[model samples]
Every structure is written in C-alpha cells, then in structure tokens.
Target: MSDLVARTGRLQQRYEAGCRLVAGCIPFRYRSSDETDVNSEKVVEVLMINSTSGPGLLFPKGGWENDETVEEAAVREAIEEAGVKGDLMDFIGYYHFKSKTHQDEFSPEGLCRAAMFALFVKEELDSWPEQARL
Candidate 1:
C-alpha cells in the first residue's frame, strides 16, 4: 500500500470575496516525434487524471490552503492527484468557475478562482494516494 495520503476537508482552505481559492497545474513532458530521426521534432504531451465522479480527465487541482503558497498547493495537488512531480515552469493564469455540486461552508456559492501553472513533469510515481481510484 502507498503511504501517501491526499488532503481532505476545507478547514484551512483559503477564500476571498466568497470565492474559494484553488491551485492547479498542467503537467507536461516533451517527447521526440521519431526516435530514429536525428532532428526529430519535440511533441508536448500533457498528463491528465481520471475524474472520480465521471468519465472525463482533468488536471490535478485542489483547494489553496492558508499554510501554503499557491505554487506549493499546485505541486501538492499534482503529486496527490496525478502521481507526478516536477518543476513548476510558468504561471498560466487564473480561471474562474462555479460549481453548485461543490458548495460548502467555505464557499457557499461554490465559486472558485483557480491559479494555474505549467509544470514540467520530472517523475512519475508508481503509486499515489489516488492511484487505487484510477
């Protein structure tokens, strides 16, 4: 069994102006289009995790807690959800969305503002907190 465990609950989650703060990243890697080609073009491949509630895939993301910076939260979510670790490359941008299904005490309206980043994946773990679900 994996020793890693994903964070749960929103007791320390950050919120502002009634919007829950989230942090996430697009985990990517570069692959050579042709292994035999000396000058093969590099292709960008993104890593996505299976959604627990449905059939779609999604980037790793979760609540922005008070104890950690946005970058830390993003990286943590990547490790927890996608079982990948890497160097956080660039700040993509903030995305705003609403989720009635996610409504909670910290975010009564389920409004969320997610800070997104670009992560260059360095390692893929054999097992992670959510690997059983996958």
Candidate 2:
C-alpha cells in the first residue's frame, strides 16, 4: 500500500464503540542560547504541524489503535505526522475536545478524548511527510 493510504488507514481506525480515544504528543526541543542561567540558557521550541484537514497548527495526534499501548500510539503518530523521534517524557494529561465532523451516535457532541504526552525530540527527519510545519 502507498504511504499515504497506510497513514490514512491508521488515522481513521476509530473504536467500534464510537467513543473517540486518541493519543498524541507535544514534541519540543531545546536550543542553546547565549543566556547565563542554566535553566534560562536553553531556548525551548515546540513542533507544530500544519493541519491537513483544517486551518491552524496542531500537535501530532491520531486515533488509538487496539494493537498498541497509548504511549506507543502517541509516538507512532508523531513519527508519521511530524517525522520526529523523541523520548516520551511525562504523561502530561488528557484533553477533551469536540469536532463537528466527529459527532456520532455514541458521542452526540462529537466529543473526543486524547491522552497527551510530553516528547523531548531527539531527531528530526531531513524530509518529513510533505506538509507545512511550525
């Protein structure tokens, strides 16, 4: 199968219950700076991917697959969507969001829950899935 098709397949695999469950990460890196203090000397920059289906930047995220743990799923999403590999840091928290297109019989409000993680990016691909990033 084509890369795009495989990616779309992974992203579109929702739970049969219609309850949207997802995994994602906030990928970030620290750059050396001229500042003095150890804490302040590193400039932190977070990676944001251009939304393929809508406007604005977004963290790499997608549907949770039955075959993988939440952390694994989050890491997979980051690699596929942002082309970044990183250490999975602390479990940040869960976020509940709503989308008009996501509404269904099980989730009338189109509500979705995502388990978010903090990923300290170690490597960035020279060429990622073709899309804008910030």
Candidate 3:
C-alpha cells in the first residue's frame, strides 16, 4: 500500500475555542520570487477586513465554515471585494508574524499561522473596489 495521507499537527498548548480566531483575504500577488519587494507596493488594493473586536490588525477568517476551504473563502472574498477574476496558482509557505496582541487574541507564538496562497489574475483587476487597502 502507498502512504497517501495528509499530516496535521496539534497545538503545543491548549486554549478555549472561543479565544481562537482567523484573519485572511490579505491579497498577495506572485512576484516571481526573483524580485525583492521587501517594501510593500500599495499599487494593488488588497482586501483586508478589520476585526469587529477592534484594537489591532485583525480580519474576518475562520478555520472551517460549512466545509469550505480557506482558499475558496479567500477567492470568494477577492471576487466580491475586488471584483477580480483570480485563479489559484500555487501554495506559498507559512510565516509567523509574532505579536503580543496576536498571542493574546489568537494563540501562542505560532498560533496565528497564516495560510499564504498566490492568486494569478486572468487580467488586470479593478483592484480598488472601494478605497480598500492592499
């Protein structure tokens, strides 16, 4: 038999589900991995939603909703917010943007693990749906 199974890791620490949170739909484009764009280029208006909780950078995201994948939700958000025809290109690596508030509201050090994916647009999207930040 072949080993064809996905692996998942459990949190190092336990916490109430109520304390957990998710924030996604941060529009990120492919930069060829060759060009170094350390500095952000607001040229493109990204879709970001502030947490209703307020105080700090938080967006509307969840682990699973009605069996919908994160990528699906992201794409749906982009289309609805930016009106862009985007297609999933590839999966990007994860990163840990550590912060005190993040640890408190989200989880421990690596609690707020973000799912970064690249979106290949069929064409230039309006990008600016309505003064949305990128």
Candidate 4:
C-alpha cells in the first residue's frame, strides 16, 4: 500500500513537471445513509471530471496542507478541476485496490495501486461542467 501511495505521489510530480496528462477526479454521490435509523437505501447520480492536459489546465491534486482533510482537498480539487460546488455530508468510504476497478498510471518512484474515495454530499448536480471536458 505504501508503494502504491508513493507511485501516486510520483504521478503528481509528473503532472507538476509537465510529464503526465491524465488527471484523477474525486467524484462524490449523495445517499440516504446519512438518514440513519432507517437502514434504507437511496440512489442518485453524481458528477465528476478529469482535468485538462495542456495550457489553461489546473494542477492535479495529491497532498494537501497540514491542517486540511482529504475530503476538503477533494472538494477543492473538484471545484478547481470541475467547476462544481457542494457540501460534503460526510465521508462515504474508500475502495481498496483489491477491487477489479483499480487502475494506476506509471510513476517514477514505483508502480502504483489505485483507490477511490467515495464521498456523500448534498445537492450534487448531474450535469458536467464545461471545465470537465478536458
């Protein structure tokens, strides 16, 4: 797991150094899980975006400031890269790399493992922002 994280850091470095083009997104969904005591479920569509590769593109996110949480960083990234705005209800969960959906790009430090951070937010729009095209 450490190796995978290291690789992700390298990926960030590449994006910063003008080496990599692909950018990741922290897409979030809103769910009924927040309304506890009912044990019921609700489904809704959410929006996300991958950053652009060339000029006018925003920098890819990796590490955050010492006082911030990853959730905050993710939200900030979404706004900068996707131009979407919303509030995080809470952390939904994290998907480990063991899942079949895992994927990672090459990193200089080592190989990488991919993971998804699921967030539950309020009032997420289904439309993709114009900035999301890249």
What tens-digit string does per-residue lDDT give for candidate 4 at 1-134? 11111122332332223222222234556467557646677657566444344344322233333344556555555554454556545444432112122223433333222223444444433543343356
lDDT of each: 0.91, 0.77, 0.44, 0.40
Off by over 4 Å in 2: 1-6, 10-18, 35-40, 103-109, 129-134
Sorted by TM-score (best first), the order is 1, 2, 3, 4
Worst 10 residues of 2 by lDDT: 1-10
Residues 20-41 of candidate 1 have per-residue lDDT tens digits of 9999999999989997896999
Candidate 3 per-residue lDDT, tens place, 1-107, comes to 11222112334222344333232344544443334666644344344544434454443233323345667755654454444556765666544443343454335
* Two-way TM-score contest, 2 vs 4, winner: 2
Top-lDDT candidate index:
1
* TM-score of every candidate: 0.94, 0.77, 0.39, 0.37
Residue 113 deviation, candidate 2, in Å?
A: 0.4
Worst 10 residues of 3 by lDDT: 1-10
Report the lDDT tens digits of candidate 2 across residue range 1-134.
11432245434445544568889999999987865566657789999988766788889988777778999989988887888889999999988777546666656777788899999999987645543433
* Candidate 1 residue pairs in clash (backbone atoms < 3 Å): none
The regions of model 1 sitting more than 4 angstroms off are none
